[model samples]
Target: MKPHDVNSTVHEPSWQIFLIFLRLGLTSFGGPVAHLGYFREEFVIRRRWLSEKRYADLVALCQFLPGPASSQVGMALGLTRGGYPGVFAAWCGFTLPSALLLIAFALGLSEWGEALPDGLLDGLKIAAVAVVAQAVWSMGGNLCPDAQRVSIMVVAACLVLLVNTPLSQVGVIITAAIIGTLLFKPAMDAPHEALPFTLSRRAGAFWLALFALLLLGLPVLAGVFESQGLALVDAFYRSGSLVFGGGHVVLPLLQAEVVPTGWVDRETFLAGYGAAQAVPGPLFTFAGFLGAAMNPAPSGWAGGMIALLAIFLPSFLLIAGALPFWEALRSQPRIQSALMGINAAVVGLLLAALYDPVWTSAIHGPADFALALLALTALSSWKLPAWLVVLGCGGIGIML
Candidate 1:
């Protein structure tokens, strides 16, 4: 990225910048974690928007926060790289395809919720176990390479697993930050993975406020119209906004909302989740499966569109709301300390997540354990591309 006096350089045109995000949204494959790799490849490695260290800092911050880390990172990257519109493009591009797919899935599932009883979805759950376990192994070693950070990871894992609290995530991150600052640890911040532009503090707050208002008000407006659109909006918005872990974590919440409404069924819901793991980009696209599957009160494609749009809207709004203000918050020393701790906690939380729901639910027996071992070895030793591992394993899953 060409350097400019923050005040003097003309920003990239919004449409052109939007195209970059759109391209990322369309082409970036895998779920949120994989998406992060893809994002680094594009914006940081390819575009050079910021050094790798800066990008890591941002990733750590988002990981600590409550929303979708990948989407938030993407939008924050955009806001820094371009501006408000940049954030918009990054979000829209990232969210749309999966949303469209989930809506379609929803349409079909609405009529077919109870067709099967076997744990076909079990395969995906198992695969998720492998993926996250691998993620924990891979990230744990790399991110928490040092002894202090390792200690932070341990404390975080115990807190979440033993005590059972989300604050554990916050605690570990804050702890790591204090340690990192005092020790001047995590010495390698990497280098510029991307470049950045700053927004006025006022502009940042404005975008966030606007997003919050829409989030609160849109459903109300939709209620006024007596349209089903509000339900879809609330579901997606809440899924994108409230969940902290990522696509996998977001699943249960999304299912609960759609399933109880009698919108989509259990079998189909699992099917979409399974198929989503196999698909590229954000797992949130499970929405696309759900959307396509839905049958609306009014009927026809309108329902599908509503479901898809509603599900994805929150991700976009969140990006808009969060990205603009990130720089100011990240710059403060204490806040930075807090985020560092939070990042470590996020890793710990991820660790706990891998064991209980993921491994236990996924690894049924020796065969499943063997497969997971294979995936971990493939990830760690063979160092194959993520997509290759996913596709090959997915093929094996279907066969098994």
Candidate 2:
């Protein structure tokens, strides 16, 4: 996009930006990859808000960051289009619908408790297996291009499966980065000029520092004050702060936090997770569900809002921290090489996720296996929208 297109007040009003993303928030589904498709359709192909190349570049930068990839992309678009207000509007529009839906689901679950039907939740879990499997396949193809990268993916997957700990994801990513640095060498190339409309370095540094402060300070505050709200914030914030690959990768981290603590039961946690797949917007909205469903004082609207904000706060800060430096960072051959390995490992992480909670929990019988195959076909072959596949699977599950 031309500089004037974003810089001029009349060119892209904040309300217009909000409305566009709001529509996406309601309709876009299938997870992060599909969200990208919807974004390209709205911003690039239809509105001409940005060029394909520019959007692709933004996507690359967001992928390298440790947050919700699609939400970060939307936020970055808003930041470029209308500054701070645009960022708020874009996030509000894209996130609120699903956040509200999941929160409502949490409330219903709280009220009904065990009285609700299990069939729908079961179907959703089965559908999630297909959804995550498809994501793993697509991401693996994109990230693991050669034999070496494939090896990285395999090793990462095997290692995580073996270790099977909360810290395993971080370890795999770090190990992959080191191996990548040692094994993969990129050809030297001249650096390009910095892109226009980049955020200031000062802003980046401030956000980075603030992120670190909250990450370190929140736990201390929670302990010192003994505030349940603060404790929830610390836990969710840490989960958001530490996530690398986004989406399903957030699952294990969240499971570790709420399940063992008795904040949320395992069945409810798994059910909410499956239901999150059917919703539009970021999968991180699952935090909202868990917040409302928690068996504590924080289990209400206030809790949902707090969890939502805390989980997403790290994304905003990380994006702010990274965007200003992205121009310089993207030009580095070694960083790019390291990202390649990390990306591959991310696919492996998803692969491991698809097996345990997603696959093992959902597929209990031959009939369930058949339904899962149907869901996969609908998603991968028939090209059905994810929401429809989820609904169809749920219906079929109820019938069975």
Per-model C-alpha RMSD? 6.3, 3.4
Kindly report which residue stretches of model 1 are placed more than 4 angstroms away from their true locations once superposed: 1-19, 30-66, 76-86, 105-120, 143-196, 210-239, 242-271, 287-328, 384-394
Q: What is candidate 1's local distance difference test score?
A: 0.62
Tens-place lDDT per residue, model 2, 1-400, is 2333223222368899899899999988878887899999988899777677778888878888888999999988888778778888999999999999999999998888578655877888888888888888887887788999999888887887677665677788888888888777777645343333676677788889999999999989999999988999999998888776668778877876788689988667877887887788899999999999889888889899999999999998898788878887887878978877788887887787778667878899998899989889988999998878888887887787
Candidate 2 off by > 4 Å: 1-11, 113-115, 186-196, 223-226
Q: Candidate 1's residue-wise lDDT over 184-303, tens digit each?
A: 322333234322555444554665676678767876877788767666666666556555545565554565566757776654565566556555556666665665666565333565
TM-scores of the candidates are 0.65, 0.90
Residue 83 lDDT, candidate 1, scale 0-100: 59
For candidate 2, the per-residue lDDT at 199 reads: 67
lDDT of each: 0.62, 0.83
* Prediction 1 TM-score vs. true: 0.65
> In candidate 1, how many Å is residue 282 off?
2.7
